[model samples]
Target chain A: MRILVLNPNSNPEFSAQMDKAVEPLRFGGAVRIDCISLTGTPLGIETQRDIDAVLDPVCDAIAAKEAEYDAFVVACFADTGVASAREVTSKPVLGICEGGLSAALNAGERFGVISTSNEARNAELRLIRSHALMERCAGMEPVNIPVVEMMHSNELAERMVSAGRRLAAQGAEVVVLGCAGMTRHQALLQDELGIPVLDPVVSTAAMALGAIAGRG
Target chain B: MRILVLNPNSNPEFSAQMDKAVEPLRFGGAVRIDCISLTGTPLGIETQRDIDAVLDPVCDAIAAKEAEYDAFVVACFADTGVASAREVTSKPVLGICEGGLSAALNAGERFGVISTSNEARNAELRLIRSHALMERCAGMEPVNIPVVEMMHSNELAERMVSAGRRLAAQGAEVVVLGCAGMTRHQALLQDELGIPVLDPVVSTAAMALGAIAGRG
Candidate 1:
């Protein structure tokens, strides 16, 4: 199956990070994952305006590539343009936030989220509430890092470790990285925290492969 | 990662069927799945006595093979001996029921379970309640097929299709096969029902791979 993992930001670096994030999934070659950035959009999907600006472009990208892929993943923690993309394609459309949270449910009873910033944390909470999963959420903590600065900051992993510890202290059995930019830190944080840490990109890609395989 | 998929029952036929059920996962060859059965346990775990009977043996098997596998999967819908097995090793121990339910959450809002028998359906409901997932469950419909007869029956797929249709009619967006014995029918039922169908053996195996990969 071919899966298009669309990073709805204009930053090519973030798209490359997502591609590296799913490197482990490439070992089997049973599914192909192509991570690409949306052109003519914001560098990072941080603000509400950024999210609103990318909706049409995200849908248009999916519509344009609809015949080329079996499934699509909206690789943003905010889940930008997932519902609209689904309306335009018959194939499965997955949102990373939803994928990460759902995979956590299998790993543990209550899960925590490590958001990139306080604003992102609030958005994550709202998304959980929309899914009626508020009760299953242990808590959400932010590293106070902005999406644009995630790749360049060496302190990113340290901040994430601290946030993960707080969530672990709050009785979270699993920790979910709330932004696609945090994908590279999943293994390190998981090792330090001694619990399952979910990268939404990998989780959603796995789900997409399962969805494609289920199509039979 | 090497994953031991232990079928607690003594039925070799069931073990072979499970091996066939996970064939799609073999393509990548990144993770090795070995499906095996206990030698002296009951042919099928159907009653409370059967569940109780497998706990020690399952724990014993895990203890014996603790050094050999990176993860373990208890391939039974009833989740027989999972908690006990976890105590025997630090490696991930997964129950197929948990894996299937968690995957369903990623696939849709609410899910229906297709059970092998009425007794199994009751156990499934109790299991969902224990997980605090009763609210997310659309309902469970049984095909009234016994675990031992699941492989021999010609009507298995037809009955599953009927149950899946009932679930779809009741607003179930995804259907989970409540018994590991129903693994081979996942694709056909999903095609017939026009929704995602989760086979617990495959789902749990996927989770096991994720867990093993996360350890890096």
Candidate 2:
């Protein structure tokens, strides 16, 4: 089964980071994943306007590629264009945040999220309330870094560790990495914080795999 | 959103038990749930043959009634005909076992199933292994009672508590009721076992509500 992983932003480096993060999840399965960065958007999708600007392009890209893939993943933490994309495909379509939250719920009762920015944290907070999972959500902590800078910076690891520690202090039993760019930091954060750290990209990949398996 | 809860057996008493189990979950949402039992089936489905025999009839019932609801639930612990039902409709169709297992994952790191019999427990065990969640599943414990007798028997509560304690002894952090007929015992079991106890019907209702919310 072929799965299309869409990073709904113009940053190729971050998309590459997401691709690298999801590579290990393709174990012992007949699943092939292709990662693509949607162009003509901001370098990092940090605001509602950025998410809004890329929705149409993301939807078009998904529409154009639906025939080639068994499932589609919206890899942005904001889950930009997921509703539209799901409307366009008969195949399983998952948002990374949705997949992460689902897996976090599977992992523990109270989950916290480590995001790229406070803006991203607020977006996730809105989702938790909308999903009626606020009672189970510990909190959202931000790295205060640009999504693109997160891929190349050494400081991100330390920042993520600190954020994870803060979340753990707030009674978070499991921590979900809210941005695809932070996927590489999952194990380090888990080790430092002593909790199950979930990477959104990897979580979405697993959920997509389950969806495909269920269909089969 | 109007959700149809289909108890895929011909026992009105069991169906009524399931309906009572789900009433507390109908909290201030636009979600309206109606529970019904599928006719012309056994009083309870305890074997693979029973599960298989009910599939075509369940599918036919779902097909005949799909338009009148926003989502459909197959309220049997075996999750009989879920894939076929999903294939037949655009609306979200969930099996109680699937819903219960999903909620169990959300509730704790490792969950155990308290089933009505060894036969039901074996079916659930197969499901856990097949879903690649064997590591997360604590184990399945049997109450050693038939499904039909569970609702009316005075000894069921004590038997269920014993099964839950055995599961907890085997490292289950949460307990899942493996039969819809066992829903009424959830609160009591949770209190007696000192762990979160999940009722399949309530869990499925929440999932269905979320599915409908996502669609809107």
Candidate 3:
């Protein structure tokens, strides 16, 4: 089976990070997973306009290659265009926010989201409300780091741990790493927080595998 | 893609009902879904011993045909042997209870489960606790009807709605049909109760599709 993970922004570094993060889920030779960056979008999708800026092209890309792959995962924490993508194809399409949030709920009682920015936190909260899972959420804690800085920063782990501690203090039993770019920090943050930490890319990829498995 | 939903019991009539319940989920020619009753088990599994009695045979069937199908869905509300099956095969294996509960958490907060028997309620609650989601659950309400009776009884819809109301009074915001055999009544109960009602079989099958989609 072949699955495509689409990074909505046009940043190769972010795409590379997402690709590497999902490596643990490849499940040997039975499934092949690939991640690609969308061209002509913003470097980082921090606002609604940034998400709106690329919905059309991403939808077009999925439509263009709908038959080539068995499934698709949109690598965005806000779940941008996920409903639209599902409408365009019968194939299963999932967004990172849905996947991560669902996995967090399954992992514990109340989950808190750790995001790259306050802007992303609003987007994440809005997405959670749309899914009706906000009642089970503790709240969102921003790491105050930009998406690009997270890619190469030495303090990324500290920021995530600090935010995770605050969310835990706020009654978050489980933590969801709200940025797909923070996929590499999942294990480290979980260890630091002493609670379950979910990575959107890994969780979505796992869900995609399950969705693909259901097809069988 | 070929998917097998195993009823894990020896009742052909119950298997037939389960088969019919999933018809709406079959998306044209993209996937083929078949429901079959397993021999050597009870007509209905109402106890932990019954689940134990069928685990080996069910695992054997999965392992025997492991190469033939893409994934498996255990059609019991008890989610019999799902973990063991995953340990035995690399393919995706889902318990209806897990799928339905996860989907419920995604759909709303404070979900309730409606089951066919008091015994089934115990099993359902145990499974919820095992998933660390007991806090999110309002409680379990039994219809007081046996699984086989639900298949032929005209009162099934009314029973589900009554149970749903009781659950609602208990603070359940969403309802999950706790039996895979109750799949046909999901839409009716949802409309009558004015809350989202989840059919375990349908949710598991849709989840299976997502799991399968992830495989690529």
Candidate 4:
């Protein structure tokens, strides 16, 4: 399957990281993937309107490339434009929120989502319910750091690992790093937390591939 | 106030109904509501493993009491534990998946649902998705049917005013609703056929009440 993943932001660095995270599934030569950074959107995560702003154009891009791909994956953890994109595409549009929630919820009866800020709380809650999974939340603790801010913070990796550890202490059998910027460190957190650390971008890509290719 | 939504699948009549339908928020006094249902488990929506099957004992029969009544909701649309009640519980659990989803998602956007089965087809994918929503569905349809044979079918309700009609014609704003029962009306077909309904039982309850109670 040929898949198009829209990052919905202007950050090429973060988009590159998302690409690396899902590269494993492509190794079997069963799927082809593209990681596109939205050309005119904001650089960091903010509000749904910010999401909607980028989403409108992203939908345009998906439509433009409709013939080339078997499916599309919206790589943003918030899963912006997911429904709209799916509306326009004949192919399946998988969102990171759906993929991450489905994977994390199935792994454990309860899970904790570590947020980048208090502002993202609604998005987090929305993602949970949209998937019929508000019941699975153990709890969510905000780190009070934005995605870009996390990248540049001192002791960044340590702080993130601390959040993961705390959620595990809260009985979170799995920890979902809520930002796409956290994708590169999924393995690091999973090892330290001693549980699965789901990177939505990577998981959505893998899930889209799997859904389009069939269960086998 | 801390609230709990208990899903009772010991017998699915109510539990199965609560899985994805929408319920309305009635009597908005000083009440905290929690809504949930047992769908993904075995027992035909009952004995779910690796989930909250154990919470049943802890849930108690809070549904009958009037004083514990700052307010309570059963969380299950089936109202499985509604009979032979006890305690002074004044509130409601608000488990009507179809009712709540209809009231909640219907208010804001076009909502539709995808089902896990095909048996409920030719049923009302749009009607249920629209109960709370005047017209929330973008598209809806079913996928696969699970193994359980259903008994009380009338509680399922017939399709009245199709919220799906608008969703399909206008390109649904949101899409959801997937469960063992809704399996009969899986979403993929609706979307494939052009109907969008979001069937998020837990999230809809949380948001609708949170919006009303002004609490998370």
Candidate 5:
């Protein structure tokens, strides 16, 4: 099975980051992963216009490559245009946010979604409601960092450990690191929290594959 | 909001039947409904191949009309591509089976999905493992009447009612009408079953709208 991973942002760095993170799937013979960037879009997406701008081109790509792929993924913190994309692809398609959130439901009764921006937090708020995870959600909080900033922050590791524990204290059975950039810290965070720290990009890959080839 | 309902079968009679079943939503508010037939497909789908054959075109139409539609729906009895659809669309694309199952989750710890065809019943059996609904589902059964036979069977009502009672006795707080063609009998079955007789199509519409636009 071939998996098409569309990063809604134009950042090749971010897309490659995801490619590296999910490289195990390809190596493990799960599926071949292809990462494509939204060429004409802004680096950061925070609005409906940002969502629509990426949708048309991405949908066109999926339609054109329908037979070539087994599944499609909209890889972003917000999971933009996922519903519309699914309308076009017979292959399974997933949004990182929705995929991770849905997977979290299986992990436990309540999970915390840790994010990078107020806009990301707002997007999560709307998505969790639409996902009907409001009842199952422990809470959502911004880590007061940017996706790029986390890579260079000296305090990234310590801050994540502290924030995760706080979320656990507040009743989070699992902590979801909300950005693809945060995946580098998943293992450490999960170890420190002594609970799950979900990476949207990784989890969505698992979910997309599960949906496509009939593994649930 | 516009909800595009795709009856994924070539049976126009079944399509018209579903159209009437969805009439209540039209009077409810500012919602517009467009019910259409799958341009080329068999009279009914009950197998994996049927699902495979109808999925692309069904998904294509919805994707083609994404700009004009607020949401898209596949109105077949099996809800064949639901898990895959959820993976793709951010616009709340819904499958009746998934919706009925989710609604059943709310009504009871276990429920049974009742289909009109052997293939649909077989499909539901696979879906229990496919969608992870096995935990909440009592089991599923086929009434052994093809949808085309519904018009000729005067006992359809009584037979369906009896099936619901048997399922309830087996611990179903709700009964999922697995066939979209059977949605017209929701009220009749609900009254006699003494529990929620869920019409997958109607319940799916409600689930999608309620999840995305908020439940009024």
Candidate 6:
């Protein structure tokens, strides 16, 4: 089976990180995962306008690749264009935010999220509400980093640890990294926080594999 | 890593089925799964009294095997004593109901559950409410079959398909088998319903594997 991990933003760095995040799941060779970035879009999906601009392009990408891939994953915390993409294909289409939250639910009763910025946190809150998981969400804290700068930010890990600690203090048993750009820090943050820190890319890939496995 | 899937009920047949349900996941050899049944409990966990009676034994079993297992899975659909078991070990402990619901959330916006009886349905509803997922739950429909008889019933698949159809009509995008004894019917039901049908045992096993992988 083949799965497409599409980063809605134009940043190739974020797409590369997402590919690395899901590398471990590819060892069994049952599924092939391809992570790609949507060209000609915003470098970072930080604003509502950025999210809106990518919706049609994301849907077009899914429709164009529907015949080649068994499943599709929208590698954005805001889950940009996931609903519309679903209307274009009968195959499974997953969003990183939904995938991360689902993984958190399995790890704990209450989960917290570490987002890239205040705007991203608000978007994630709306997504959580849509999933009817507002109660199980302990809280969302932002590191105040921009998505484009996440791969280069020296204090990103420290800020993430700080946000994670605060969430844990609020009784969060699990923490979800709300941005795909933060994919590379999952193991480190999980080690420092002593709680499960989910990488949305990895969680969604696992879920997609489960979806494919169920078909047989 | 080693994982113990403890079926709180005393039925050996059910325990064997649970073992079979998770067999496909053993291919990678990264984790070992062992399914065991408590020796002196009731044949099947039905009423509230049965749920209550297995609490201590489940906790004791976890405590006794804590050093040997990397994680613990409470395989009963009621999740007989998961919270209490957590107090006995620092290892990750999962309940099939929570795992199944978490998987369902990944599969769709709204999910329906197929239960064994009215009592089991009520128990599952309580579990869903505890997880703050009542809003995402479309409904629970019971087939009225006792847990012990689920495997022997020739009409089990037909009843499950009927229940799934009703749930789909109610706008449920996914279906979850609320009983571990119903594990064998997952793929068949999914084919018949044309939607994802989750086996709680399989779902919980996948989560346990994820938890183990995250530790690295």
What TM-score does structure 4 among the candidates reach? 0.53
Write model 5 residue lDDT over A73-176, tens digit each, in one string.
78886767677776785456777776666555434447898877667788788877765557667877667776657666787788778778777888997677
Give candidate 1's root-mean-square deviation (CA, Å): 2.1
Q: In order, what DockQ does each candidate have?
A: 0.42, 0.03, 0.11, 0.03, 0.03, 0.47
Clashing pairs in 6: none
Each model's TM-score, in the order given?
0.93, 0.55, 0.63, 0.53, 0.53, 0.93
Q: Which ten residues in a row have the lowest lDDT in candidate 6 chain A?
A: A22-31
In order, the first chain's TM-score in every candidate is: 0.97, 0.95, 0.95, 0.92, 0.90, 0.97
The C-alpha stretches of model 2 lying farther than 4 A from their native spots are A1-216
Clashing pairs in 5: A82-B88, A82-B89, A82-B90, A83-B89, A83-B90, A83-B91, A86-B88, A93-B87, A93-B88
Scored against the true structure, residue B131 in model 6 reaches a CA lDDT of: 82
Tens-place lDDT per residue, model 6, A1-216, is 588999999989988888777776665564588999999999999998999999999999999999999889899989899989988998889888887788788778899999889888877888889978889899889999988899889999899999999999999999988887776677889889888888877877767766665555
lDDT of 6: 0.85
Q: Write the per-residue lDDT of candidate 6 for residues B90-198, one digit (tens) a residue.
A: 7889888887888788778899999999888888888889988899899888889988788789988889889999999898899999887777788888888888898
Runs in model 5 lying further than 4 Å from the true structure: A47-49, B1-216
lDDT by residue (B60-144, candidate 4, tens digit) is: 5453334443323344323233322222232433333443343323223455554333444323443343222233445555434
Best by lDDT: 6
lDDT for each residue of candidate 2 in B64-160, tens digit (9 for 90 to 100): 9999998888998887888788668867787777666765554455789998888887888887664445666888989988877877878889899
lDDT of 3 by residue, B43-81 (tens): 888788987898887898889878888779888888888
Docking class of 4: incorrect
Query: What ranges in model 4 sit over 4 Å off?
Result: A214-216, B1-216
lDDT, candidate 1, B13-131, per-residue tens: 88898888776665556657899999899998998899899999999999999999998989888888887787788788988887778767767779999998888888888888877
Off by over 4 Å in 6: A28-31, B28-31
Per-candidate RMSD, Å:
2.1, 17.2, 8.1, 13.9, 17.1, 2.1
Model 6 clashes, total count: 0
